[model samples]
Target: MFVARSIAADHKDLIHDVSYDFHGRRMATCSSDQSIKVWDKGDNGEWNCTASWKTHSGSVWRVTWAHPEFGQVLASCSFDRTAIVWEEIVGESNDKQRGQSHWIKRTTLVDSRTSVTDVKFAPKHMGLMLTTCSADGVVRIYEAPDVMNLSQWSLQHEISSKLSCSCISWNPSSSRAHAPMIAVGSDDSNVTYGGKVQIYEYNEVTRKYAKAETLMTVTDAVHDIAFAPNLGRSFHVLAIATKDVRIFKLVPLRKDSSSSAPTKFEVQVLAQFDSHNSQVWRVSWNITSTILASSGDDGCVRLWKANYMDNWKCTGILKGDGSPVYGSSGQPGALSGVLGSAAAQSALNGATGR
Candidate 1:
């Protein structure tokens, strides 16, 4: 069974993005009101606001958390045409109150010519790396030279795309035998570009990122894309949010021993869902990548799962009225809600009463 539990997270304006930490115990939210707030889940299964501060001079578009091994770090991109890295200082005396953790600005990446649309921390195995995309159609990757130092970062690579890049996700699997890979999505609605989704692979010999593949079927503007966390699967699964929710499977080809040509791969559409009648804005996979949760303009969040036969199906849907509608198969449902509303209410009430 599924039930909606709303906790108030008062924010002054529209909340643009929310990101949970690797452990899923902490969350960070950014808003158009130029502020960011942090929440921690308590032992009682409730969430409380721990910190809130004015973060940027303009609307903050996205906030993402680095792996916990990096010490509670966060990255946010904004309409101010810059991205900021924040670090949480533990056991520090707050200016207004004693014995509170203080979040300090670590470094500001100011390279984008237009509004920064997205920011993401690279997988932990990649070691202290961050990537950002902007309305200028450029993607920049930055790295902390020293893992212990959060204040200094160096621009490692910059790639310019033909369309406005909206979001990116790093392939979490790190096999020393294979090159690093990342998936990028653009917000371009033009069909002439072939597709809004593209994959880039890092070439060790050339020391550059090269285009691996383009998903030609996704013609609509892509709001977000995520490469699922791989377990032991031989192939990779990618979830995309266009006008609808689309899933694709990427199978890598074995390198030919006799030939010197670079390795190749194939991408096939696995499923396309029309459950959300409007545009889907976000798609997130659980840690196991066994299920996917998507939210859209319909004011609802839908959960999709695959059966043993590899057939994908909608398992549950959470409506705006806080009701769960199960699929015909009678599988158990999952919880979903409007995270922004809770933040807005909390912001207005000036207390954690909700």
Candidate 2:
């Protein structure tokens, strides 16, 4: 059996989100430390810190990288009532030979009333849309600047929900011919009473986006959701982490059934493994879409893999020496820093001695 490799360390507080770049060459993580650090692969097969930035005044809750279409642009959300954008710049030959980078601050967006909870970019290239959810129970879309300028993002429209949104994910399977679509999950009260996973479709003729339908509701709150990564073909699955981690095979149709009520989409439960004792915080898929990783308030990271029968089984667990991920306790940042540093060192040292 192949062993699980330690990729990076934990945060000082709970790690709210983890995301990979389009090429899967880099990873970005955000935590309660109020900072976002970008990790890249080194020649020795080790992960090294490429860049770091303190983007949020309060704890950063979520982060996502822009699609290849956007050229390394990053978006992060925080409890500080704002979301900030970050970009990476490759230094010129002379500057690179001297081992230095010319980093720049492209833009920063602020929301006065609501604390931004999550942020996501459209999946395709040359895409100019961005979606953000806030504590004000509103989801807003903005048109990214044509160039690198971020002085102002034109607000497209805002969709209001009964409760604040906790998470959001854009469908990666839709092609250019079809209208864009996004899925969102809200708090438990909203999940049980209001529509849980609401799908929004962009209408070009109306120049507006309308709620097409609701997916499925759960008994507990929905915290995080992720679209499956495409190996060679487009991703046709979505995994949701909340009170439970659920995998759904998305069946995209050429013509969307026009219905106003919540229709339970034919979702196949690939696997449902209860590895975490507490509420799961985040879930991610590798480029292959075969393996899944989940983190929880229980302070453990569990790895799940699909078997021959297409059944998902818990294969590994990463424990944190007994720490609480939710409350004011637990040192998620320092521990993660040390562990990440150690992991990098180990990879550099190779399969030999430490």
Candidate 3:
């Protein structure tokens, strides 16, 4: 059954994003109040606030954690037209006395002229890299030349989409047969612009990223995009949040080994859903990429799963802190507990003062 668990996020304004660490034991939340808070899960399964501080002068849009291999590091982008990297430091005597953690700003990226909407850390297999997309229709990739020196980052590549970008996801495939790739989504309102999703692949010969494919069927403004965790699969799965939730399957087409051209994909739309009745704000997949979760303006999180025949269906519908609105008879429903839910009941309560 679906259940309600009060997180008491304690942000002064609406929370925009919530991100769990690689281990799923730690989390960070960013809010419109221009602050970010880190939470640590206790042995009793309760999340305790370990650090809270102002992260930007403007509303923070997204916050993400780096691979645990890089230590405790976080990256955040905001409406302030900049992105900042933060590192957690413990045992400062005063902090140690209180048994608290402290996060310091390691670097700030100010390349975008418009608000930075999304920030993400690349897959661990890609080394220590960061990507940021802004409303100015630009995507920038940065790398820390030295893992030990967190204060310095070099802007490696910049790609212009010619459409306002709202979100991005890096293909997590670690197989040698696949190349490093990224998908960028746009929130541009002009319907005249054909498609909103673009896929780019790293060209080893050219030593740069090249446009491989454009999802022409996705004509709507995309709010969030995520690539399913690759588990030795030859094809890739992508979930996009827009007016509706959509799933796309990208099968890599075979190419000549001597070809320097980017690999092409046989793109197919697996599923499209409008059960939310409004814009879907976020989409996330389980670690295994079997179950998908989407939240929207209708105030419900719907879980999707595929059957043995690869037919995708909604297995459950859960409201914010309430009894079961609906559920599948045998489907594993509770959603990894409450740690991954970003749109907590606080938003519903805050709007009506209930």
**Candidate with best lDDT:** 3
Question: Candidate 3, 260: how far from true, in Å?
Answer: 2.4
Ranking of all predicted structures according to TM-score, beginning with the best and ending with the worst: 3, 1, 2
**Taking the tens digit of each residue's C-alpha lDDT, what string does model 3 give over 1-354?**
334546888999888888888877888888889999999889987889998999999999888999999999999999999999999987754735385788899999999999999999988988899999999989999999999999999999999988999999999999999999999999888877778999999988888888999998888889889999889999999999889999999999999866889999999998999998988888888777888888788877787889899999987676765544744465444544532333232222221100
TM-score of each: 0.90, 0.75, 0.92
Summarize candidate 1's per-residue lDDT along 244-277 as a digit string, tens digits: 9999999988874344343466888889997788
- Tens-digit lDDT track of model 2 for 1-354: 222346554456655555667665677777777877777767776767666667788888777777766677888888888877766678633534343343456666675377788888877652667788887778888777674565457777788765668888776655564456677777645444745666676666666667765655454677777777654443257777776677776554444445433223445556665667677767766555666767666656655677898778765555543332332453322222222321222121111100
Query: Ten residues in a row with the worst lDDT in model 2?
Result: 345-354
- Give the lDDT ranking, best first: 3, 1, 2
Candidate 3: stretches off by over 4 Å: 1-3, 93-97, 327-354
Question: Lowest summed-lDDT stretch of 10 residues in model 3?
Answer: 345-354
What TM-score does prediction 2 earn? 0.75
Q: Is candidate 1 or candidate 3 better by TM-score?
A: 3
Each candidate: RMSD: 5.1, 8.4, 3.6
Error of 2 at 170 (Å): 0.6
User: Candidate 3: lDDT of 97?
Assistant: 37
The number of the candidate with the highest TM-score is 3
lDDT of 3 at 245: 95
